[model samples]
Each structure stands twice: as C-alpha cells, then as structure tokens.
Target chain A: MEASIRTGEKETGRKKVLISALLFMGLGHLLHLKQYLKGLFYAACEVLLLVFLPKIITGIGNLRTLGEAQPHLPIRERANSMFMLIDGIILLAVIFIFIIIYIISVRSALAAYDQTSSAGAKKTKQGLNKAFPILGLAPGVGLVVFFVIVPLIFSASVAFTNYSSPGHIPPNNTVDWVGFDNFVTLFGGDATWAGALGRVALWTVVWAALATATCYFGGMLMAVVLKESNLRIAPLFRMVFILPYAVPSVISMLVWQNLLNGTFGTLNRTLRTLGLISSPIPWLGDPWLAKFMVVLINLWAGFPYFMLLTLGSMTAIAQDIYEAALIDGANKFQVFRKVTFPIVLYQTAPLIIMSFTHNINNFGAIFFLTGGGPMVKDSTLTSAGGTDILVTWIYKLTVNLLKYNYASVLAVMIFVVLAPLAIINLRRTRSFREGEL
Target chain B: MQPKTTKVNIYTIIVLLFLTVSSLLVLYPLVYVVSAAFSPGNSIASLNIIPFGDGTTFKHFDHLFKNTNYLIWFRNTFVIAAATSICTVFIASLSAYVFSRFRFTLKKPMMMAMLILQIFPSFVGMVAIYVLLLRIGGLDTLWGLVLVYLAGNTPYNTWMVKSYLDTIPRSLDEAAIIDGASHFTTYLRIILPVAKPILIFLAIASFTAPWMDFIFPKLVLRSAHKQTLALGLFSFVTDKKNEFTNFAAGSLLVALPFILFFLASQKLLIESLGFSTVKE
Candidate 1:
C-alpha cells in the first residue's frame, strides 16, 4: 500500500482482487488501494477479533460449571469468581458482535476500493451515509441481545445444570452440571415434582381451555343475543361489558381478590349479613372453590376481549350470508349455527388459539388473585398451590424456593409445550403468513 | 329486509332480563369499589352494597394522600410508565423501520430470532434477568425496571409495528429516496406521520403497563420508596387485613386515571388490537 502507484478504473482487476482479499480485513485497502492508515486500523480490528476467539471457546467451556470452582479455589486462584457466567456471556457476545463488525469492515473496505478503482480516484470516503442503519439498529438490538437473549441463553444453559436448592446455589455453594437429573426427577416418579407437575400441568391445560372457551362462547352468545334481539342500546351494553377489559387487569384482579377474600371479603361479609350462609365461606382458601374463583375472576377480565374480537369479526361477516341462509328457509338458530358461527369462528380461530396460549401464561390474574392459593395439606407438591398455573408455579419455585434448576427445567418444559402452539398459531394467521417482508 | 318470521314471546322477555342481569353483574365490582372508596367506615366489613355506605367521606383518600408515600409511588409509576412508553415507541419504531424497509444480511434470521424470542414466554428468562439486575446493581431502581420493561416489550411490539408498517406502500419510500432524502429522513419525516395511529396506540399500551404490572416491578423494585403503584397497593392487602379500606381507596384513586385514560383510548386500543390481531 505504501509503495504502490495510485490505482484507477483501469485497475478493475485490482479492485476484484481487493474485494476477494476483504476476507482478511484491511488487506483490500492495503494491497489493492494504497490507504495505509485505514488499512492498519482494519488490521488492528482483525487482530482484536482474533483475540476474542479463544474467549468464546472458553466461555462455552465454562458454561458447564458456571464457575462454581471459584468458591472452592484459593484466593489467588479465583478467576472470574463474581459473574463468571456474565463474563463468559459478555465475551461470547462481544465475539459475535465483532464477527458482524468484521463482515461489515470487509465489505465496506472492498466497496471503497472498488469505487476508488471505478471512479479513477485514489481516495474514497463513503462517510456517514453507511452509518445510518448501524446507528439506528444499535441501541434496540444491543439492549435486546444483552437483556433478553443473554438471559434466555442462561436459562437454556441452566436447564442442563443443577442450579437448584440445597447444594447447588452459586457463590457460597457450587453448582455443577447434573445432566438430565432434574428432568428425570421431574419426569420420573419423584413424588413432589411429578405430582406437582401432573396436577399443575393438568390444571393449566384445563384453565387455558376453559378460560378461552368460557370467554369465547360467552362473548359469542352475548353478541348473538344482541344481534338477534335487535337491541337498540347495544352500544351501551357493549360499553358496560368492555369496562372490565379496559381497566388495567391488575387493578381489577386485586379488587376482585379483596371482593372474594374468604374471611372479610365484601362478598362473604355481605352474604353472611344477608343470612345467605350460617358461616363465612373460604372462597379462595378452598381448593375447588379457588380453582373456580380463578376461572371466574379471569372470566370477568377475559370475556370482554373475546366479546370485542367477536363483535369486530362479526361486523366483517356479510349480512348477505344470513340473508342467503334465511332465503334457504334457515331458521334463526339455523342461520346462526350455519352462517354466523362458522364465519366468526373461521376469522377468529387464530385469536382463540392465541388467547388459549395467553391464558397459559396469564401470570398476572392468577398470581395476583390467588397467589396460586389453597395450599394442599397432604399433597406431594412443593411450593405450588392448587390454583397455580405452570407459570406461577415456576415463579413460586424459583423466587420462593430457590429451586433454580427445577424452575429452569420447568421453564424449558413450558417452552417446549407452548412455543409450538404459539408458533403454529402465529403462522396460521392470514396477515402474518401473507406478509412478504 | 322483508319478513319478521320469528315472534317475540316469553323468550324475548327472558333474554332482556338476562342481558340486564349480566350487565349489572359486570358493573357490580365497579359500583362496589366506588362505594367502598367513598364509604365512611374504615374497614372492608363495613363496605355495604349501598353506594355510599353508612356515610360518605374522603378520609381514606385523605389517609392515602397524607399518611403514606402514595404520591411518591404515583410519581414513580408515572415516571416509569411514561419512560417505558416513550422508549418502547422510539426503539420499536427504529427497529421496525429496519425490519420493514431495508433488507439486510441478517434480516431473515433477525426476524426469526425476534419471533422465536417473543414466543418463548418471559418467565423462562426471569431468573437471568433478576441475576443480571443484581449483578449490575439495577435492583430497587426505577431505571432498572424501565430497562426490563423496555426489553420485555421490544420484540412483540417491534414485530407488531413492523407488520403494520409493511402495509404501507414501498412507493412512498422510493419517492422519498428519489427526492434526495436519507433513509432515516424518509423514516422520520415521511413514514412517521403515516404511522402515527399505531405509535400513539403503542405509547398508550406501554404507558398503562407499569401502572398495572405487578410481577416484573415487584421483582425488580424492593424498597418501600421504590415501589410502584401496583406494588404499594399490593403491600396493603398482601399481609394483614386492617388496611382493606385503605387498599380499596388507593385502588380507586389509582384506577380513576386509568379508567378515564382507558375509556378515552378505548376505541383506539380495540382498533390497535384488531390491527395486530391480523398478525396473530
């Protein structure tokens, strides 16, 4: 680069060579176009990137133990004692980012060389024009990868390790890879885990399906009744219904929690005062009632969403379909069954599926209302309450019990169970599938 | 338009009565809570079905205002919610711009990554976030909660907004580029105005998040002073029972703004949901 003659358009062959040489960072600028300073900077970047390669490998290696050995090691021997896992992830992420940077550098340097040779100019400064996308994408992507993706990877890794209660906590205690022991414990005949998993998993499915069904059909029934009866004040009815949905769910649920509280809740107190019952009912402290209350409270918050969704889709259904059905001698019920119901269902099927999935992870309502209540007295479960869904159960396990390994295993299990349903629901929708870009 | 084949009879009367009862049932909680807020007595037991039970007074509201850090919690919630809204909109807009407009090398993979990231529920990564916050000393801080809230919302919001943006004609972008504007300029000037509805919708949706959110804020914020409205109000009832009236009053006060804000944005919110519903 230093001694070469200035290259120009006639050096298209040199530009092609430089483009190919872009694989080695500044080689394009150095050998094809004489730009010594820029070439050296690119070379330094390449060297620095190479320096991060071993760090990535070591990070992956250290992922197995998560640096538990640091606690057992001598003071002088402790390496990355704090945030060994974090350090590893940061190193690996830096390596990943540097690779991307390397690709950009190589491509940009090659473009500069190509333009220098194309325009017969010895120097080219493409300037900040190319920096726009990078600048725009940096903050969003950085925060997402750091805060979201990194934690996800940690969870994924922890799923394979023994980072649970007792002997496996970090810092004071060391956590090591226990292979599929947690999964085995969960899946095997371990009474506490398996019983809890089976019970909660079954309820989760029932809750999700029932929540969606009750909300959905209830909404549909309401819409049909209003549409059929020719209610002039339908908007007013609709407004009243939508109030529960519009209010932030946490406030509504918490309000309901107090309303339904067993001892002194307004419902129990009012009922007792009215001589409806001889004694106060433990509405949330009883298992069956707690489950019923979870669904019932969730319904109060959930049904309106379906009502609106059904109403919107119902508006899209052609009145002509009903007219056609009517002309075919279809009764009112027949018209609804054959015409209105199917069209509404077809349009809102994806949403119904999504709502089910949402209800599965509908953490706030269940967690806030019951805190997964009615702890079973003689059950084989630990940390989980009767009304607890898988999500809240996982929460109790992690935060309350410090069963990180079991929680992570449960997390992975949840991902396995729900991710497919979610992906299928997402892809089944027309809008997303039809979107080309 | 011609025939009235079905006659109204007992079923019609039953239907009307049933509908009225259902509506009343839906309105029951609000009426009861509103009454409790204004109830003269200082306990949940005294919360009668009547609208202004015993006598109407503002003492609970007064207690909430004077004796507690309700204002600080309100201030913190507003600050967090507002910051989250603005940040989510701005960041999601930019990310969605690249996603919608420009085709890059990682475009497909990035899209897939975001989609997959979104599908995996947030609790799967909950522990990692807690650990990360602890390591970075983000625990018990408002900014830390904001950061978490922003990250948690980014993928889904970005994808939703991007799908909406994709519906805009590419010809607009082409014309702007032909007019010698940068891509960012076109995105900022030409595209943003058109995307105003969804942006406002996103802002409102996110603005309401921290106000109502219990779990994440509960996890990230620990101290009394750092508590958001959700956590502070939760603490009132999560323990012993004497603060029931106070909790009801606080919930009423907290919900007043939200109820108003929500009613105002009700149509817009539904419209946005319907719009994003198209994306599954």
Candidate 2:
C-alpha cells in the first residue's frame, strides 16, 4: 500500500509539472495545487502577454527590418526607422520581463507540487510574504530596463546601421543595417577616419593615464606633507585645499576658462601688469599648450578628492606599524616608502583604476575648459579637435556633426575596453564576492 | 604626536610655504570670480590687477534677478535634483534591502547585471533617451530629466547601498522577523534608520549631480523657461553672449551654498565614501 501511494504521488507531480509547462503558466496551480491566488496572478500575466502578442511580434519584426521605405509619401509622412527601432527594443524589453515571470510561475508550480502544500488564506499570505523581495526589486528593475537597458540596446544597434544626417535622417530617409562598415571605416577603410580614430584613441589612453597619475601623486604629496607637518594653522590650510573640489566643477572650469582666455582673461592681464610677458600667452588657444593646461587644470580640480581619500586611508593605518618601522632604524622617508605608501596604495588601488576610467570619460574637464577648440590641422575632417578625447569626440560627432554611426562605434569600443576592468574591479571588492552576504 | 618643540623646523617651514603658494593658486580664481561678480562692469577686461576689481556693486545680482530667467532655472534645477534625490534614495534602498536580506535564484545574476551596466558609456544612449522622452512627452520637461538621472543613478547606487546594508547585522533583521514583522516593516523601521548615513551621502551626491552637469540638460531641455543653472549660466559666457559679470555672480551664488554644504559634511561624506568603497 505504501509503494502504491508513492507511485500515485509521483505521477500526480509529473502531471502538474507538465500541465503548467505545456498548457498555461498557472493551470497546474489553479486546477490541481489549490494555489488560487498565485495561480491567478500568473494567469493574469499570460492574459496580458496574449493581449500584447501581436504588437510585440510586429515590433520585433520592425526591429529586424527597421522599416519599409515609403518614398511615395511626403517626408513628414514617411516611415521613421529610428522610431521603429527604438519601439522594437522597448517591446523586446517587455517580452523579456514576461518571460521572467513565466519562468517564476513554472518554478513556483513545481515547488508547490513537490511540497504538496494545499493552499488557504494563510498560505496565500505566506506566498505574498515570500514575494516581498520581488515586489521591492520590480520597480527599480523595470525602470532600468526601459530607461537604461533599452537606450543602451538602441545605441548599440546604431553601430550596425547607416544613421547619420543630411540624407539618412528619419522621414527624409530610412536607416538600413550596414554591418561592420562603420567599424571598418574607423579601423582602416578610410584614411582620415582611421587616422582620427588612432590619434583620439591614443590620446584618450594617454590622457587617462596622465590624469590618474598626476592627481594620485599630487594628492599623495599634499597628504603626506599635511600628516608630517606640525604647522599651527594646518586645519585652515586643509579647508582651503578642499575649496577647488567643493566648488561646482562647472563654475571652476568656467572660471579657469576666463582666467586663461588668451585675449581678455585675468591671468594674462595680471601677468602683463606685473611685466611678466610682452604679449598675452595662449594658455588654451594653442593645441599643445591647451593639452598641457587641460591636465594642469584637471589636477587643480581633481587632486583634493584624492587628497581627502588618502588622508582617510592614512588615518586608518595603525600607529603600531609606524612605531615598528621607526624602531627598525628606518627614518621618516624610509617608513613612508616601506609601510605607509604600500598600505595606502593597497587600500586605494581600485579607486585609482576607477579614476582612470573616470578620466577617460572626463568630458566636462575638456569640453568646458577648451570646448575642444583650437582644432588640429586635420581634425576638422572628423569634427574632433586637438584636445578631444574619445568621449568628447563622440559628443562632437553626435551632437555637432550628426555622425551617429561613428559615435556609436566609439561607444561600443569604450564598452569593450571597460567591461573587463569593471569585472576585475568587481572581483577586488570583498563585498561583491559571490555568496558572501 | 611628535615631541613639542619651541623652535620651528626648516621642514615645517617648507611645507607651510608650499601649502600657502598652492592655496593662493587655488584661491586666486575664486577671488577673481567673486570680485567680478561685484565689479561695476560686465567684462573681465576692465578689472585691475587686484581681484577687488576697482569697487563693489550689486548690479549683477540685480540683473540676475530682474532681467533674466535665473529664478526659473533655479526652480527647475532644484525640482529635478530634489526629485532625483528622493526617488533614487527610496528605490535604491528598497532594492538594496532585498539584495541584502533575501536569497533568490536571480539575485547573483541581477547583482552582476548592475555592475555590467556601469561599463557602458551612459550618454552614448543620448539619441535613444531623447527619442524615448519625446515619445513619452518628457522632452523639455523637468520630470523627463529626472527619469534619465534616476535611471543612471540606480545601478551603482544600488551596489553602494547594498554594501552599506551588508554591514548592518543580519541578527537584527531576524529578531524583527521573529517578532512577526513583515519584510518591509523591518526594512522601514530597522534598516532605514541604521542606513541613514549612506542614504544621506547618496542624497547629497544625487542632489549635486544636476548642478554640475551641463551636457544632458542642454540636450533634453530646449525652452528658455526650462533651462538649468548650468545651462543658463553657461549662456552668459558663450561666444554669442559675454555677460561675464552676470555669469560670475550667478556662479558664486550657486557655488557659495555648495561650498558651505561640502565643508559642513566633509567628514560624513568621506566616511561614507570609505564605507561604500572599502572592504573590511
């Protein structure tokens, strides 16, 4: 009798699983498991999906073909592939959300059948209680999907299309897929485009490196000086040092722009009054000088942050370690080199890399200070300037030049380069360790 | 900690001298901006060698209030920043609480997704965001800017809050649940109070982001009535316009309060940054 009952239970569980999997998301729970509330919720999802099915299909189809050309119609009345592409991506996001719900429904059915837990009001309460996390996460995840993910997908899609201005703008024209063409043009196909890409990419890397290093070392120097000094008014100086960082960067950059303006800026005016130079210097008007000034100005705006960070990390270093180093016959400089520097670097290595990435996209520092101006001799062809890094160049391309395809290609390259660094960063953070929390 | 010395050492003298020179380098522009704001002219050209700029006047402030859309821009930016702050805090904290306290199958993948999202250059999607907002009637609207900021804020902030929340003892949560508290009630009454520091940091960070940001507002908002402080003040110094004094006055007004806030909250901000970024 026991064997027979076990067999019957096994067959019933299989039946419920099959029903939930094959027929509908909630049929097993509704018909056999007595989980009426949970089943109804799942069933409602299915109903919603069915209602939107035709729209979803067409949206995805439009995404694939972009859109059919309607050349006979007026420009204002013609089909817009860009709109269709965006709408299709949004629809795809919705479908993914539905699929996630469907999986959850199936899993819940399996669990309920396995446990043979017949439902009541109390069981429904437990079910809702178990779903608290999902409910909490739903709104944020939903917004990210639509706003972040959809936009991201749409932009990435642009890399594979011919979506520039003049001839290909929507209504006047329709975009079509041209796989690898933008990338090829950037890499080697066109001499000007290829050269622009090489120069911008090289400058971007060099700029990130120099920016990260200068701020890091400059801040470290100030932090060490402050720690070692016994100045009477050090607190006052510390506050002063932080002023550059505290003031809004936009304000600071604009101020610097005015101060360094070759013609009428206060810096040049003050210098001339003091008899420093016969003529005004083009601090930002000359390409090489502009690049140098960019790094220097970025140092001014950026170092205080690292200074504060270093100070915080230094304070956390143990007094015993310093005492031990001193006891080992090491002088102050030796102690710093051997113990303090290593400790601080270990603590802040991740942040240093993070800052590197930040500087790579430091659009404001370049854009506001120079407006990516004093254009290089050949940079006008690509609409980028001497000081334009990859990001600012991308900005110029999309916003100023209407070169969507090329901008998207650069954006993709940024992703390809940065994703691995982010993963490495994730691995470094102990809090991000899998199953740790 | 060093032995008290009556004599000032050469090392200390050098350090102080270096600091003074650097501080002046940092201070000159600020002083110049302030002097320009009050100077009796509209250009930086007339200013003297001293940053005091001949004399002081309130004309720029007067002009800022009466002749321009400064107040409207202020109101618009204030609204967008406040909305973004409140929504980011609530939504990020809610999701963080789940990631902290709950164990679901998708939890790891979701966490990983958040990190990967940061790898993408956010503004690359500017075209899509523009179109999306246009379709939803968010263009030229403050709320549309808020949505974009809130979306951008969610991923990294969720991780930061989650890291902070992890430091809060799980036993307290278990005790609440044992006392028959629902998950949300525990989150509201127990977790939020303890997580106040990180949340404050997040709030301040998000609040200040819109003030410094010049790019997105320029893209999303077109109407003169809807411009932000950054965009409006930027207009004063652009190639087409040169109201440098007006720009200076406006910027000083914005920067003064921010500087004060940063000074007051320095410790809280630094500590919170350390908490979120550093592992034990």
Q: TM-score for each prediction? A: 0.90, 0.97
Candidate 2 ranges with C-alpha deviation above 4 Å: A1-4, A117-127, A432-437, B1-8
DockQ for all models: 0.59, 0.70
Provide the lDDT at B210 for model 1: 77
Which candidate ranks first by TM-score, i.e. highest? Answer: 2
lDDT of 1 by residue, A60-164 (tens): 677545664656676565543225666677667777877787776676666665676557785444434455677778888988898889888778777777777
Best by lDDT: 2
Clashes of each: 0, 0
- Give me candidate 2's interface root-mean-square deviation: 1.7
How would you encode candidate 1's per-residue C-alpha lDDT over B1-280 as one tens digit per residue?
5434466666677878988999988988888778877787766666675667578888989989999999999999999999999999999999998888776667777777787777667757887888789988999999999999898888888887887787889998889888888877888898888889888889888898778877788788888788888888877776565566787788888777766776676566555555554444
RMSD, candidate 2, Å:
1.9
Instruction: Give the clash total for candidate 1.
Output: 0
Candidate 2, A292-375: lDDT as tens digits: 999999999999998888888887788999998888899889999999899888888889888988998898999989988778
Which stretches of candidate 1 lie above 4 Å from their native place? A1-23, A29-64, A68-82, A107-126, A319-329, A377-381, A429-437, B1-6, B9-11, B49-51, B278-280
Q: What value does the lDDT take at residue B64 in candidate 2?
A: 96
How far off is residue B186 in model 2, in Å? 1.0
